[model samples]
Target: MAAALDIKGLKVSYGNIQALRGVDLTVEEGEIVTLIGANGAGKSTLMNTVAGLVRTREGAIHHYEEDITGMDTRELVKRGIILAPEGRQIFPDLSVKDNLLMGGYLRSDKENDETMKTVFELFPILEERQNQMGLTLSGGEQQMLAIGRALMAGPKLLLLDEPSLGLAPIIVSNLFKLIKRIRDMGVTILLVEQNARIALKTADRAYVLESGRIVAADRADVLLKSDLIEKSYLGKS
Candidate 1:
Protein backbone atom coordinates (compact mmCIF):
# COMPACT_ATOMS: atom_id res chain seq x y z
CA MET A 1 0.00 0.00 0.00
CA ALA A 2 1.13 3.50 -0.74
CA ALA A 3 1.76 6.02 1.99
CA ALA A 4 -1.08 8.35 2.90
CA LEU A 5 1.49 11.13 2.88
CA ASP A 6 5.06 11.16 1.56
CA ILE A 7 7.56 13.96 1.78
CA LYS A 8 10.93 13.77 0.03
CA GLY A 9 13.85 16.03 0.65
CA LEU A 10 11.32 18.67 1.79
CA LYS A 11 12.86 22.03 2.44
CA VAL A 12 11.33 25.36 3.38
CA SER A 13 12.64 28.80 4.30
CA TYR A 14 11.63 32.15 5.69
CA GLY A 15 13.83 34.76 4.02
CA ASN A 16 17.35 33.39 4.63
CA ILE A 17 16.57 31.21 7.65
CA GLN A 18 15.81 27.67 6.60
CA ALA A 19 12.97 25.97 8.48
CA LEU A 20 13.23 22.52 6.93
CA ARG A 21 16.35 21.05 5.41
CA GLY A 22 15.76 18.01 3.24
CA VAL A 23 13.32 16.39 5.64
CA ASP A 24 12.04 13.01 4.48
CA LEU A 25 9.19 11.08 6.07
CA THR A 26 6.12 9.02 5.28
CA VAL A 27 2.80 8.23 6.96
CA GLU A 28 1.23 4.99 5.87
CA GLU A 29 -2.51 4.58 5.54
CA GLY A 30 -4.37 3.88 8.78
CA GLU A 31 -1.49 5.05 10.92
CA ILE A 32 -0.81 7.74 13.49
CA VAL A 33 2.62 9.25 12.73
CA THR A 34 4.09 11.72 15.16
CA LEU A 35 6.86 14.26 14.60
CA ILE A 36 8.52 15.08 17.92
CA GLY A 37 10.88 17.96 18.47
CA ALA A 38 11.69 21.13 20.39
CA ASN A 39 10.10 24.54 19.77
CA GLY A 40 12.29 25.54 16.83
CA ALA A 41 12.87 22.09 15.46
CA GLY A 42 10.65 22.73 12.37
CA LYS A 43 7.81 20.33 13.17
CA SER A 44 5.09 22.95 12.80
CA THR A 45 6.80 24.32 9.71
CA LEU A 46 6.62 20.92 8.05
CA MET A 47 2.92 20.63 8.91
CA ASN A 48 2.12 24.05 7.45
CA THR A 49 4.11 23.26 4.34
CA VAL A 50 2.16 20.03 3.86
CA ALA A 51 -1.11 21.88 4.42
CA GLY A 52 -0.05 24.39 1.72
CA LEU A 53 -0.09 27.25 4.21
CA VAL A 54 3.66 27.59 3.75
CA ARG A 55 5.40 27.46 0.41
CA THR A 56 8.28 25.05 0.03
CA ARG A 57 11.61 26.11 -1.37
CA GLU A 58 12.53 22.62 -2.59
CA GLY A 59 11.55 18.92 -2.79
CA ALA A 60 8.18 17.25 -3.21
CA ILE A 61 5.06 16.31 -1.23
CA HIS A 62 3.01 13.39 -2.38
CA HIS A 63 -0.40 12.32 -1.09
CA TYR A 64 -1.37 8.79 -2.04
CA GLU A 65 1.22 8.56 -4.85
CA GLU A 66 0.30 11.85 -6.53
CA ASP A 67 2.78 14.68 -6.46
CA ILE A 68 1.19 17.62 -4.61
CA THR A 69 4.20 19.79 -4.15
CA GLY A 70 3.17 23.46 -3.88
CA MET A 71 -0.52 22.75 -4.28
CA ASP A 72 -2.78 25.60 -3.23
CA THR A 73 -4.16 25.30 0.29
CA ARG A 74 -7.77 25.44 -0.93
CA GLU A 75 -7.06 22.79 -3.53
CA LEU A 76 -5.43 20.65 -0.87
CA VAL A 77 -8.55 21.00 1.28
CA LYS A 78 -10.72 19.83 -1.60
CA ARG A 79 -8.51 16.75 -1.89
CA GLY A 80 -9.23 15.70 1.75
CA ILE A 81 -6.04 17.12 3.21
CA ILE A 82 -7.36 18.95 6.24
CA LEU A 83 -5.37 20.68 8.94
CA ALA A 84 -6.36 21.43 12.52
CA PRO A 85 -3.67 24.04 13.04
CA GLU A 86 -1.48 24.45 16.13
CA GLY A 87 -3.56 27.22 17.62
CA ARG A 88 -7.31 26.68 17.89
CA GLN A 89 -8.08 29.12 15.10
CA ILE A 90 -11.86 28.99 15.36
CA PHE A 91 -14.03 31.90 14.37
CA PRO A 92 -14.46 33.69 17.69
CA ASP A 93 -17.73 35.46 16.90
CA LEU A 94 -19.40 32.52 15.26
CA SER A 95 -21.54 29.97 17.04
CA VAL A 96 -20.02 26.55 17.52
CA LYS A 97 -22.18 25.11 14.74
CA ASP A 98 -21.25 27.93 12.43
CA ASN A 99 -17.58 27.35 13.05
CA LEU A 100 -17.98 23.69 12.18
CA LEU A 101 -20.01 24.60 9.13
CA MET A 102 -17.10 26.69 7.92
CA GLY A 103 -14.97 23.58 7.84
CA GLY A 104 -17.45 21.98 5.45
CA TYR A 105 -17.68 25.06 3.31
CA LEU A 106 -16.71 23.00 0.27
CA ARG A 107 -19.66 20.65 0.82
CA SER A 108 -23.37 21.22 0.41
CA ASP A 109 -25.68 21.10 3.44
CA LYS A 110 -27.25 17.84 2.26
CA GLU A 111 -23.87 16.09 2.26
CA ASN A 112 -22.63 17.24 5.68
CA ASP A 113 -25.24 15.89 8.10
CA GLU A 114 -23.57 12.53 8.63
CA THR A 115 -20.20 14.16 9.09
CA MET A 116 -21.76 16.55 11.61
CA LYS A 117 -23.35 13.61 13.37
CA THR A 118 -19.96 11.90 13.68
CA VAL A 119 -18.43 15.08 15.01
CA PHE A 120 -21.19 15.42 17.59
CA GLU A 121 -20.79 11.81 18.66
CA LEU A 122 -17.08 12.32 19.14
CA PHE A 123 -17.75 15.50 21.05
CA PRO A 124 -21.13 15.53 22.75
CA ILE A 125 -20.36 18.90 24.27
CA LEU A 126 -20.37 20.35 20.78
CA GLU A 127 -24.05 19.44 20.56
CA GLU A 128 -24.75 20.98 23.95
CA ARG A 129 -23.01 24.21 23.00
CA GLN A 130 -23.93 24.26 19.35
CA ASN A 131 -25.35 27.71 19.59
CA GLN A 132 -22.71 29.13 21.90
CA MET A 133 -20.16 31.62 20.64
CA GLY A 134 -16.82 29.94 20.03
CA LEU A 135 -14.98 32.38 22.29
CA THR A 136 -17.14 31.43 25.24
CA LEU A 137 -15.77 27.88 25.53
CA SER A 138 -12.92 26.88 27.84
CA GLY A 139 -9.55 25.77 26.49
CA GLY A 140 -10.32 22.07 26.26
CA GLU A 141 -13.73 22.72 24.72
CA GLN A 142 -12.11 25.03 22.18
CA GLN A 143 -9.65 22.31 21.25
CA MET A 144 -12.50 19.86 20.80
CA LEU A 145 -14.27 22.39 18.65
CA ALA A 146 -11.18 22.72 16.50
CA ILE A 147 -10.91 18.95 15.95
CA GLY A 148 -14.66 18.64 15.38
CA ARG A 149 -14.47 21.39 12.84
CA ALA A 150 -11.71 19.57 10.98
CA LEU A 151 -13.74 16.34 11.03
CA MET A 152 -16.56 18.21 9.36
CA ALA A 153 -14.35 18.46 6.28
CA GLY A 154 -14.41 14.70 5.83
CA PRO A 155 -10.64 14.51 5.73
CA LYS A 156 -8.86 11.44 4.39
CA LEU A 157 -5.57 12.61 5.91
CA LEU A 158 -5.62 14.78 9.02
CA LEU A 159 -2.70 16.99 9.99
CA LEU A 160 -2.89 17.89 13.66
CA ASP A 161 -0.32 20.33 15.06
CA GLU A 162 0.20 20.43 18.78
CA PRO A 163 -3.19 19.03 19.78
CA SER A 164 -2.02 18.78 23.40
CA LEU A 165 -0.61 22.21 23.86
CA GLY A 166 -1.65 24.36 26.84
CA LEU A 167 -4.14 21.88 28.30
CA ALA A 168 -3.94 20.29 31.77
CA PRO A 169 -2.41 16.84 32.11
CA ILE A 170 -5.76 15.10 32.43
CA ILE A 171 -7.15 17.00 29.47
CA VAL A 172 -4.06 16.14 27.46
CA SER A 173 -4.53 12.47 28.31
CA ASN A 174 -8.16 12.60 27.22
CA LEU A 175 -7.21 14.50 24.08
CA PHE A 176 -4.67 11.85 23.08
CA LYS A 177 -7.29 9.15 23.68
CA LEU A 178 -9.63 10.99 21.35
CA ILE A 179 -6.85 11.26 18.80
CA LYS A 180 -6.40 7.49 18.87
CA ARG A 181 -10.15 7.13 18.50
CA ILE A 182 -9.94 9.31 15.43
CA ARG A 183 -7.34 7.03 13.86
CA ASP A 184 -9.45 3.98 14.65
CA MET A 185 -12.25 5.66 12.73
CA GLY A 186 -10.03 5.37 9.62
CA VAL A 187 -8.68 8.87 9.15
CA THR A 188 -4.88 8.74 8.83
CA ILE A 189 -3.10 11.22 11.08
CA LEU A 190 0.16 13.19 10.83
CA LEU A 191 0.70 14.74 14.23
CA VAL A 192 3.28 17.33 15.29
CA GLU A 193 3.64 17.48 19.04
CA GLN A 194 5.91 19.19 21.57
CA ASN A 195 4.95 16.82 24.37
CA ALA A 196 7.26 14.11 23.04
CA ARG A 197 6.39 11.48 25.67
CA ILE A 198 2.67 11.32 24.87
CA ALA A 199 3.35 11.79 21.19
CA LEU A 200 5.61 8.77 21.20
CA LYS A 201 3.16 6.78 23.27
CA THR A 202 0.25 7.47 20.93
CA ALA A 203 1.90 7.16 17.54
CA ASP A 204 2.46 4.03 15.47
CA ARG A 205 5.66 5.52 14.07
CA ALA A 206 7.69 8.46 15.26
CA TYR A 207 10.30 10.87 13.87
CA VAL A 208 12.63 13.04 15.86
CA LEU A 209 13.52 16.39 14.28
CA GLU A 210 16.41 18.60 15.17
CA SER A 211 17.55 21.87 13.62
CA GLY A 212 15.29 21.49 10.58
CA ARG A 213 16.15 17.91 9.70
CA ILE A 214 15.02 14.42 10.61
CA VAL A 215 17.48 12.87 13.04
CA ALA A 216 15.70 9.63 13.89
CA ALA A 217 12.76 7.54 12.70
CA ASP A 218 11.41 4.32 14.17
CA ARG A 219 8.41 2.47 15.53
CA ALA A 220 6.93 4.46 18.40
CA ASP A 221 7.43 1.68 20.93
CA VAL A 222 11.06 1.19 20.01
CA LEU A 223 11.80 4.89 20.01
CA LEU A 224 10.19 5.26 23.43
CA LYS A 225 12.71 2.81 24.94
CA SER A 226 15.84 4.29 23.39
CA ASP A 227 18.32 5.75 25.86
CA LEU A 228 18.61 8.93 23.74
CA ILE A 229 14.85 9.46 23.67
CA GLU A 230 14.44 8.69 27.39
CA LYS A 231 17.10 11.16 28.42
CA SER A 232 16.37 13.88 25.88
CA TYR A 233 12.59 13.99 25.67
CA LEU A 234 11.20 11.82 28.45
CA GLY A 235 13.34 13.53 31.14
CA LYS A 236 14.82 10.30 32.52
CA SER A 237 18.03 8.33 32.16
Candidate 2:
Protein backbone atom coordinates (compact mmCIF):
# COMPACT_ATOMS: atom_id res chain seq x y z
CA MET A 1 0.00 0.00 0.00
CA ALA A 2 1.10 3.53 -0.57
CA ALA A 3 2.18 5.56 2.41
CA ALA A 4 -0.33 7.75 4.16
CA LEU A 5 2.09 10.68 4.04
CA ASP A 6 5.45 11.07 2.32
CA ILE A 7 8.00 13.85 2.06
CA LYS A 8 11.14 13.85 -0.03
CA GLY A 9 13.99 16.28 0.14
CA LEU A 10 11.74 18.76 1.92
CA LYS A 11 13.33 22.10 2.71
CA VAL A 12 11.97 25.14 4.49
CA SER A 13 13.73 28.40 5.26
CA TYR A 14 13.07 31.51 7.29
CA GLY A 15 15.05 34.29 5.64
CA ASN A 16 18.65 33.05 6.00
CA ILE A 17 17.85 30.16 8.32
CA GLN A 18 17.00 26.76 6.84
CA ALA A 19 14.62 24.92 9.13
CA LEU A 20 14.52 21.64 7.18
CA ARG A 21 17.42 20.40 5.12
CA GLY A 22 16.53 17.67 2.68
CA VAL A 23 14.44 15.87 5.28
CA ASP A 24 12.64 12.78 4.06
CA LEU A 25 10.05 10.67 5.87
CA THR A 26 7.10 8.38 5.35
CA VAL A 27 4.17 7.37 7.53
CA GLU A 28 2.58 4.12 6.58
CA GLU A 29 -1.17 3.76 6.80
CA GLY A 30 -2.53 3.22 10.30
CA GLU A 31 0.82 3.91 11.92
CA ILE A 32 1.90 6.56 14.40
CA VAL A 33 5.20 7.94 13.14
CA THR A 34 6.92 10.40 15.42
CA LEU A 35 9.59 12.97 14.78
CA ILE A 36 11.57 13.67 17.94
CA GLY A 37 14.40 16.09 18.45
CA ALA A 38 15.69 18.90 20.61
CA ASN A 39 14.59 22.55 20.56
CA GLY A 40 16.02 23.54 17.20
CA ALA A 41 15.27 20.27 15.38
CA GLY A 42 12.61 21.93 13.20
CA LYS A 43 9.96 19.41 14.25
CA SER A 44 7.30 22.09 14.47
CA THR A 45 8.51 23.65 11.22
CA LEU A 46 8.12 20.33 9.44
CA MET A 47 4.58 19.86 10.74
CA ASN A 48 3.56 23.40 9.78
CA THR A 49 5.04 22.99 6.35
CA VAL A 50 3.13 19.74 5.89
CA ALA A 51 -0.07 21.46 6.96
CA GLY A 52 0.52 24.18 4.36
CA LEU A 53 0.86 26.91 7.01
CA VAL A 54 4.45 27.44 5.86
CA ARG A 55 5.72 27.38 2.31
CA THR A 56 8.28 24.80 1.27
CA ARG A 57 11.24 26.02 -0.70
CA GLU A 58 12.05 22.56 -2.09
CA GLY A 59 10.86 18.95 -2.34
CA ALA A 60 7.35 17.57 -2.35
CA ILE A 61 4.66 16.41 0.05
CA HIS A 62 2.42 13.58 -1.03
CA HIS A 63 -0.62 12.26 0.76
CA TYR A 64 -1.63 8.78 -0.40
CA GLU A 65 -0.16 9.43 -3.82
CA GLU A 66 -1.57 12.93 -4.20
CA ASP A 67 0.91 15.73 -4.60
CA ILE A 68 -0.20 18.36 -2.09
CA THR A 69 2.92 20.41 -1.64
CA GLY A 70 2.25 24.14 -1.34
CA MET A 71 -1.51 23.54 -1.28
CA ASP A 72 -3.50 26.05 0.78
CA THR A 73 -4.32 25.07 4.34
CA ARG A 74 -8.05 25.40 3.75
CA GLU A 75 -7.91 22.95 0.87
CA LEU A 76 -5.74 20.63 2.89
CA VAL A 77 -8.38 20.57 5.62
CA LYS A 78 -10.99 19.67 3.05
CA ARG A 79 -8.79 16.82 1.94
CA GLY A 80 -8.78 15.31 5.43
CA ILE A 81 -5.48 16.79 6.57
CA ILE A 82 -5.79 18.34 10.02
CA LEU A 83 -3.24 19.82 12.37
CA ALA A 84 -4.06 20.19 16.07
CA PRO A 85 -1.10 22.55 16.30
CA GLU A 86 1.09 23.52 19.23
CA GLY A 87 -0.10 25.86 22.01
CA ARG A 88 -3.63 24.41 21.83
CA GLN A 89 -4.78 27.28 19.63
CA ILE A 90 -8.35 27.35 20.90
CA PHE A 91 -10.46 30.47 20.72
CA PRO A 92 -10.33 32.19 24.12
CA ASP A 93 -13.66 33.90 23.73
CA LEU A 94 -15.63 31.02 22.30
CA SER A 95 -17.53 28.41 24.23
CA VAL A 96 -16.04 24.93 24.29
CA LYS A 97 -18.83 23.70 22.06
CA ASP A 98 -18.43 26.59 19.67
CA ASN A 99 -14.71 26.12 19.45
CA LEU A 100 -15.21 22.49 18.52
CA LEU A 101 -17.91 23.45 16.11
CA MET A 102 -15.52 25.82 14.41
CA GLY A 103 -13.40 22.84 13.50
CA GLY A 104 -16.23 21.38 11.45
CA TYR A 105 -17.14 24.65 9.79
CA LEU A 106 -16.63 23.05 6.40
CA ARG A 107 -19.32 20.49 7.06
CA SER A 108 -23.09 20.70 7.24
CA ASP A 109 -24.98 21.26 10.49
CA LYS A 110 -26.05 17.61 10.71
CA GLU A 111 -22.53 16.32 10.08
CA ASN A 112 -21.11 18.72 12.61
CA ASP A 113 -23.65 17.62 15.20
CA GLU A 114 -22.82 13.96 14.68
CA THR A 115 -19.08 14.57 14.84
CA MET A 116 -19.59 16.72 17.94
CA LYS A 117 -21.32 13.80 19.61
CA THR A 118 -18.36 11.57 18.77
CA VAL A 119 -15.93 14.12 20.14
CA PHE A 120 -18.01 14.41 23.30
CA GLU A 121 -17.78 10.66 23.77
CA LEU A 122 -14.02 10.85 23.30
CA PHE A 123 -13.62 13.66 25.81
CA PRO A 124 -16.61 13.67 28.14
CA ILE A 125 -15.22 16.72 29.90
CA LEU A 126 -15.76 18.62 26.69
CA GLU A 127 -19.45 17.88 26.87
CA GLU A 128 -19.51 18.80 30.55
CA ARG A 129 -17.92 22.15 29.78
CA GLN A 130 -19.63 22.65 26.47
CA ASN A 131 -20.86 26.08 27.41
CA GLN A 132 -17.77 27.18 29.29
CA MET A 133 -15.41 29.67 27.71
CA GLY A 134 -12.23 28.13 26.30
CA LEU A 135 -10.02 30.40 28.39
CA THR A 136 -11.51 28.99 31.59
CA LEU A 137 -10.24 25.45 30.97
CA SER A 138 -7.10 23.96 32.55
CA GLY A 139 -4.06 23.27 30.42
CA GLY A 140 -4.79 19.57 30.08
CA GLU A 141 -8.44 20.21 29.40
CA GLN A 142 -7.41 22.75 26.79
CA GLN A 143 -5.21 20.15 25.15
CA MET A 144 -8.07 17.67 25.07
CA LEU A 145 -10.28 20.32 23.56
CA ALA A 146 -7.67 20.95 20.90
CA ILE A 147 -7.52 17.28 19.92
CA GLY A 148 -11.29 16.92 20.11
CA ARG A 149 -11.72 19.91 17.85
CA ALA A 150 -9.34 18.47 15.28
CA LEU A 151 -11.35 15.25 15.28
CA MET A 152 -14.33 17.35 14.40
CA ALA A 153 -12.70 17.83 11.01
CA GLY A 154 -12.72 14.05 10.43
CA PRO A 155 -9.08 13.85 9.49
CA LYS A 156 -7.65 10.91 7.56
CA LEU A 157 -4.13 11.93 8.61
CA LEU A 158 -3.60 13.93 11.81
CA LEU A 159 -0.63 16.15 12.50
CA LEU A 160 -0.01 16.64 16.20
CA ASP A 161 2.66 19.14 17.22
CA GLU A 162 4.00 19.00 20.78
CA PRO A 163 0.84 17.61 22.32
CA SER A 164 2.70 16.83 25.52
CA LEU A 165 4.59 20.09 25.71
CA GLY A 166 3.21 21.77 28.84
CA LEU A 167 1.24 19.15 30.72
CA ALA A 168 2.15 17.39 33.93
CA PRO A 169 3.76 13.98 33.68
CA ILE A 170 0.52 12.22 34.54
CA ILE A 171 -1.37 14.24 31.98
CA VAL A 172 1.30 13.51 29.45
CA SER A 173 0.93 9.80 30.04
CA ASN A 174 -2.83 9.91 29.54
CA LEU A 175 -2.39 12.12 26.48
CA PHE A 176 -0.10 9.53 24.87
CA LYS A 177 -2.67 6.84 25.54
CA LEU A 178 -5.31 9.04 23.97
CA ILE A 179 -3.05 9.52 20.98
CA LYS A 180 -2.83 5.76 20.48
CA ARG A 181 -6.58 5.50 20.77
CA ILE A 182 -6.92 8.20 18.16
CA ARG A 183 -4.67 6.22 15.83
CA ASP A 184 -6.71 3.10 16.45
CA MET A 185 -9.70 5.02 15.20
CA GLY A 186 -8.20 4.57 11.72
CA VAL A 187 -6.57 7.95 11.38
CA THR A 188 -2.87 7.90 10.53
CA ILE A 189 -0.74 10.13 12.77
CA LEU A 190 2.44 12.09 12.19
CA LEU A 191 3.49 13.39 15.57
CA VAL A 192 6.12 16.00 16.34
CA GLU A 193 7.14 15.95 19.95
CA GLN A 194 9.98 17.21 22.13
CA ASN A 195 9.12 14.65 24.80
CA ALA A 196 11.41 12.06 23.26
CA ARG A 197 10.87 9.21 25.68
CA ILE A 198 7.10 9.41 25.60
CA ALA A 199 7.10 10.03 21.88
CA LEU A 200 9.07 6.87 21.26
CA LYS A 201 6.83 4.90 23.56
CA THR A 202 3.76 6.08 21.69
CA ALA A 203 4.92 5.67 18.12
CA ASP A 204 5.30 2.59 15.97
CA ARG A 205 8.30 4.10 14.18
CA ALA A 206 10.49 7.06 15.02
CA TYR A 207 12.76 9.52 13.30
CA VAL A 208 15.44 11.52 15.05
CA LEU A 209 16.08 15.01 13.74
CA GLU A 210 19.12 17.12 14.43
CA SER A 211 19.74 20.60 13.10
CA GLY A 212 16.86 20.17 10.63
CA ARG A 213 18.20 16.91 9.25
CA ILE A 214 17.22 13.31 9.87
CA VAL A 215 19.98 11.53 11.77
CA ALA A 216 18.24 8.29 12.66
CA ALA A 217 15.10 6.43 11.61
CA ASP A 218 14.03 3.11 13.06
CA ARG A 219 11.44 1.14 14.96
CA ALA A 220 10.48 2.95 18.15
CA ASP A 221 11.34 -0.01 20.34
CA VAL A 222 14.78 -0.36 18.77
CA LEU A 223 15.46 3.33 19.11
CA LEU A 224 14.40 3.23 22.75
CA LYS A 225 17.11 0.66 23.47
CA SER A 226 19.85 2.59 21.68
CA ASP A 227 22.67 3.86 23.89
CA LEU A 228 23.08 7.03 21.89
CA ILE A 229 19.35 7.77 22.08
CA GLU A 230 19.39 7.07 25.83
CA LYS A 231 22.16 9.60 26.46
CA SER A 232 20.80 12.26 24.15
CA TYR A 233 17.00 12.10 24.54
CA LEU A 234 15.89 9.51 27.05
CA GLY A 235 18.19 10.78 29.84
CA LYS A 236 19.13 7.22 30.67
CA SER A 237 22.44 5.36 30.45
lDDT string for model 2 (91-131, tens) is: 99999999999899898899899989888887899999999
Candidate 1 local lDDT, 14-81, one digit each (tens): 99999999999999999999999988999989999999989999999999879999999899999999
Model 2 residue 51 distance off true place after TM-score fit, in angstroms: 0.4
Q: TM-score for every candidate vs. truth?
A: 0.98, 0.98
Give all candidates' CA lDDT scores: 0.93, 0.93
lDDT of 1: 0.93
Model 1: CA > 4 A from native: none
Error of 1 at 77 (Å): 0.9
